[model samples]
Target: MAERRANVWLAAWRRAVLDRLPRNREDAPWLWILAAQAEADLSLARRMAIVEVLRDGRPHPAPDLQAAVEDRLGEGCFGAQVEQTLEADITSLRAWSIRIGCSDTPGVGGYYLKDPIVKAMDKPGYEEHPNPMQAQIYRSMGDARKMRSMFEMFEFALHQVGIGTRLRHPDWDDEQVEAEVRRLVTGIEPTMG
Candidate 1:
């Protein structure tokens, strides 16, 4: 069930990204490249966030791990089913030989990374090819792409809501519609203008 939920969330996210992309693929060859890179970067960010949280070598409860991931990747990045997403990510990490352990003991149990030293050697040929500067730059680009995508999604949602508001209240002017939208978003009534 959790894996299914995570897959659904990921598919929706990918669809959103693809929908916002340019229609003419020939005109913008880099569009697909950028989108693919962004997807890869975001995936890495999610898994790395989990790994970083567990790097302390202590048992972190599910809620703490979830909160830490949200803090690391920004809120809403993991979608609504965050626990499921985290579980999916952990599963992916373990597939990569990450050795994550889980405990169910009440008050003294959670998830933790075992043998952090092995992480460095998990991937062959990359142990001596570390490039901190390049990695930092790539991460920065990924972060920028994520922020831009998020803002684009936000703007699209707001535009749709505005359109709906206008359609429902054809008598309302632009200011009135904007006010209503603001009210819907913030739950605060617009003052008399």
Candidate 2:
């Protein structure tokens, strides 16, 4: 059932992407590949938005949370299926080991993170400690900066992994190296031939 729902969402997402693409770009063989990557990024962003909305650890009503996600994702991103998309996002987050609590009462109660992930800065360490003013400055940079920084960090990490993979397998071609990197990053083993 979940797989069927995912396929439905995937088809809808592909249609949306195709609708936005220029006629010239529509015939490109890589169009579907690009669409898949865009869908992955969108799914990640949606999950991140959900985590941010629930980060306060307070139970937020369903409608309010849905609206917050829509706002975070910008206008028209969710079409008319925002609620279903939000539920799927929540499920994806849970699959990644995030614990989200939904209210027993349908639509009225709320949702919250059972255990919010703490930032490294918040943890006690032997490194340099920021002054109270500096901490305030850091906090004031806002969500956009935070999200961008996270993406940059993620990209750098992936690049490093790719480099390491290439170094370790010097004889491998680019496709072989990329497959290894993908397997390592995603933990999905390649099928035995």
Q: Kindly state the number of residue pairs that clash in model 1.
A: 0
Tens digits of per-residue lDDT for model 2, 1-193: 4334434555665676577767855586576785566455666656766787898776788778877766666654555787787788888889989999987664337889988565657656764666899678768888999899778887787688899998988999988887778777766656656
Clashing residue pairs for model 2: none
Off by over 4 Å in 2: 1-40, 105-108, 117-193
Candidate 1 wrongly placed segments (more than 4 Å): 1-40, 117-193
Q: lDDT by residue for model 1 over 107-151, one digit each (tens)?
A: 558999996455555556747676899777657777778789778
* Predictions: Cα RMSD each: 19.4, 20.3
Worst 10-residue stretch by lDDT in candidate 2? 1-10
* TM of each candidate vs. truth: 0.40, 0.38
TM-score of 2: 0.38
